[model samples]
Target: MKVVHVDYRINEKINVNQFYDLLVNSTLGERRPVDDVECLAGMLLNSNLTVSAWVEGKLVGLARSMTDFNYACYLSDLAVNRIYQNRGIGKQLQILTQAQLNKRCKLILISAPTANGYYDKIGFTNNPRCWVLERDSDISI
Candidate 1:
């Protein structure tokens, strides 16, 4: 089989279909709202930082994040095509994402249940204090 060249780029604009495809092709699709195109579009349009891996011009992996470049970075999405998972593309994507952050900024992500072990193996410390308020939920305070 011929080898496809892989390239990594930062802050590249990836369209919704490409984003949806990559998400769905990876395990993340099960947890993401892939059927909602508008949501996916909004996600790509609103993210402040995005690191993507491409092979022969097709998006194969991505790291989408929102950060102020100073204190904290929320790594909202990290996905690699199932076919591309073991080749280090996902790790490289995270590395590129960190390269754009300020020295004091720390990357944070809520691990998908299936990916917890992978994150642990990659030097991520498990933090048990994360909390979330669903979009449809009301504030009680």
Candidate 2:
């Protein structure tokens, strides 16, 4: 097995451009709003918790989440640079994210289709009750 050296950071002040670049290099860019820098900035600003992995000061992996720090934590985005995948960087990011919350807090997330099996291997259970509301969707009375 190859050992990867990484530096993990929590709530580090990072620029949106770096995030955009990393996302663009990862599979996450496919589902993210990479064309909108404003949206990406908002996403980063609103997130209360973020665990990032850096290699030689370059952004490689990140786990962004929103939480109350006591009850529920929704991991909104988990992205690893394509060149740095399969080196446990993603798993470490999650672990660091979890460490910030209390034991009572539950970590939740909606996995990307291709990442479902990866989550399973990392000890996340499949929950089928998740629902999505698109921007164009309507709320019925």
Candidate 3:
């Protein structure tokens, strides 16, 4: 078997189709807005940090995040093509993301139900108090 030589690029702007394709090929796609190109474009354009993994010019993993650099970082998406899932690319992507932050910033993410164990294995402490307000939910002033 030929060993795949993976290269990691930090904060490089990626083509939307490549990003969309990797998302769809990874397990995270099940929870992403894969059918909406505009939404996906906005996601890439607005994110403050992105780390991507490529093998022979093909995108195989990505970490997309939003952060203030000093307080908190919301790791909005972490995906690795199913074929590349077990080689530590995901952990390295997270590490690269953290490296761009201020020393005090805390990396945070809402684990996809299927990925909680994986996060635990990679040193993420479970925070049980996270709450969410869906975009469609009514709000009171």
Candidate 4:
């Protein structure tokens, strides 16, 4: 058997290029504002918790989240390079992300349509109560 190592980290500052490259190589690129450098910068700058996976100093996987460390944690983005998927990197990213939070802080995320089964198999239950509000959309109550 071949032994492989994946380094999992917390709060490490990763540059936009590294992050952009990873997203471009992953399935997430399609859904992100990759062409918007400012948006990418803001996303990283605003995230309070970031767990990353590195292989030989190269950014391979990342989990960017926003959390209060007390009540709730919203995992905004979890992406693994397309070539590196299904090797347990994504799961490790989530594991490390949740590890940073208090036990009472429920880790939550809106799964990509393609990733729904993946989250379910990794101990996340389905919750239809989640809602979204796009920037241009109006709130009518």
Cα lDDT tens digits, model 3, 1-141, are 447889999888798999899989999788989999999999999998999999989999999999998999999999999998889999999999999999899999999888999999999999999999999899987
- The TM-score obtained by model 2 is 0.95
lDDT of 1 by residue, 17-40 (tens): 999999999999999999999999
The local lDDT score (0 to 100) that residue 20 gets in candidate 1 is: 92
lDDT of 4 at 118: 97
What candidate 1 gets wrong by more than 4 Å, as runs, is: 1-3
* Per-prediction backbone clash count: 0, 0, 0, 0
Looking at candidate 2, the ten consecutive residues that score lowest on lDDT are 1-10
TM-score of each: 0.95, 0.95, 0.95, 0.94
C-alpha lDDT score of every prediction, in listed order: 0.92, 0.93, 0.93, 0.92
For residue 127, what is the lDDT in candidate 3?
96
Which portions of model 4 miss their true places by more than 4 Å? 1-3, 139-141
lDDT of 2: 0.93
lDDT of 2 by residue, 49-111 (tens): 999999889999999999999999999999999999999899999999999999999999999
Q: Which candidate ranks first by lDDT, i.e. highest?
A: 2
For model 3 the TM-score comes to 0.95
Stretches off by above 4 angstroms in model 3 are none
